[model samples]
Target: VGDALKDRFDGASRVMSNSDHETSVQRNDAAPHRIPRKDRYRFQLRPHNPDHKSPGVKDLVYLEPSPGFCEKNPRLGIPGTHGRTCNDTSIGVDGCDLMCCGRGYRTENMLVVERCN
Candidate 1:
């Protein structure tokens, strides 16, 4: 039922005509049509059998042929975090351990001069 609905929605734009839209609008304006109770109950009782093996379904859901995220590929605009500063104490995404991708990190101290008016 889900796949059928998806196919119908996908093809609606190509198949729908101006006359069809006008008719639908007219019907809507006349009386807001409500689904029959029996039909609603039947829809609810319908079993969902997903098409796991279908190539179309697989291509729609899975991320295939994705770009390489880690390496510094200038052409792909992926300026990898080779020397990015990360917090050493926090056990989060910003932490040195995770940011460095288990490659480890180095620490250095520097002096800065600031002026305020």
Candidate 2:
């Protein structure tokens, strides 16, 4: 099964290379306002035993695409960083500027009580 899938992928790569070359040549004479057509391919799986009643690859297909995690979505269980800790001094993604999403942060100071014997 693995070998058959690998062979199919290799063949698809060759076809893609040829189509890419043809598209590049066509782009030279194509209008700036025109959009290029995208290439689409479909694959079907054929089991060794036809009598088997197992589900095919189509069973893994989803009806709708997933909603990404850019903002807070309670329905999707994505708790976007509203009160999450962030670094005010740093400039990375964990920094206050990016993490707060332009909403300014307030600084809070807390005293810790520890007992050590």
Candidate 3:
């Protein structure tokens, strides 16, 4: 979903109609500022198979990032805490897989699963 949203946004700007004001802007600065270059939407998933040893599902909470978080942290791949194989899979958190950050939980290389209350 995040990837799709990004594609749509990119496409819209590419075909934007040019008007007098639009064309008057400096060539380098002319751009739709709605979605900044430095932003990524956030989504999370919970593991269908729960791991008791890891953090209880009840204690876990998904901390949503601001509109531009992805852009700010684009360099960081899917959060390592979610699991070593997180990157191989899409952003789907299911079964034993827990996402630490929307991209990768804050902690590095640790998949933090909150206990489900």
> lDDT: which candidate is best?
2
How would you encode candidate 3's per-residue C-alpha lDDT over 82-117 as one tens digit per residue? 234344344455312343344543324767999998
Q: Write the candidate numbers in order of decreasing lDDT.
A: 2, 1, 3
Q: What TM-score, computed on C-alpha atoms, does each candidate reach?
A: 0.38, 0.36, 0.13
Error of 1 at 6 (Å): 26
Higher-scoring candidate on lDDT, 1 or 3: 1
Q: Each candidate: what lDDT? A: 0.55, 0.58, 0.38
Candidate 1 Cα misplacement greater than 4 A, ranges? 1-61, 109-117
Cα deviation of 60, candidate 1, in Å: 11
Error of 3 at 32 (Å): 39
Model 2 agreement with the true structure over 79-111: per-residue lDDT tens digits: 887889998888998988888888789977789
Which pairs clash in model 1? Answer: none
Q: Rank the candidates by TM-score, best first.
A: 1, 2, 3
Which is better, 2 or 3, measured by lDDT? 2
lDDT score, residue 9, model 1? 52
TM-score of 3: 0.13
